[model samples]
Target: MVAVTDKSILGCRYGSSQPQRDTVLYADLYREGRLLLDELVTETYPVEDFAKAADDAHHGRVARGVLVF
Candidate 1:
């Protein structure tokens, strides 16, 4: 199961009951330079090119993208 709780800002998958713990663990990993989130962003585009970004994402051309304003 997967869930996201706004109050705790927790997101979990695979039936994890300890979402809070997972959040902390991930935070620690990021701080330790183990989680490379920037590498996941394969593309970035200005908000003006939102349509292009969306298209690329839909076409599987973009693995992950950030739309900047």
Candidate 2:
């Protein structure tokens, strides 16, 4: 299972939860999502760079790893 939550000052959404006990896999998925968002912003919102705005969302998950509960 996978879950995401948004609890930031500007309201960002990131993070993922899985039932599996694989830290590497979770990290890979999280990184992929971050890269995707980065690319999306670089291509679409070059001027505003809204993707950076969601850094906190991604950072929170990366810092804590995958949530198993």
TM-score for each candidate, following the candidate numbering = 0.56, 0.19
RMSD of each: 10.3, 17.0
| Full-model lDDT, candidate 1 | 0.89
Per-model CA lDDT versus the true structure: 0.89, 0.45
The prediction achieving the highest TM-score against the true structure is 1
Q: Tell me, by lDDT, which candidate is best.
A: 1
In candidate 1, which residue ranges exceed 4 Å CA deviation? 1-14, 46-49
lDDT of 2 by residue, 1-69 (tens): 877677556643444444465567767877878434343332222335445434634665233222222
lDDT of 1 by residue, 16-46 (tens): 5587788898889999999988888999999
**Candidate 2 to native Cα RMSD, angstroms:** 17.0
Clashes of 1: 0
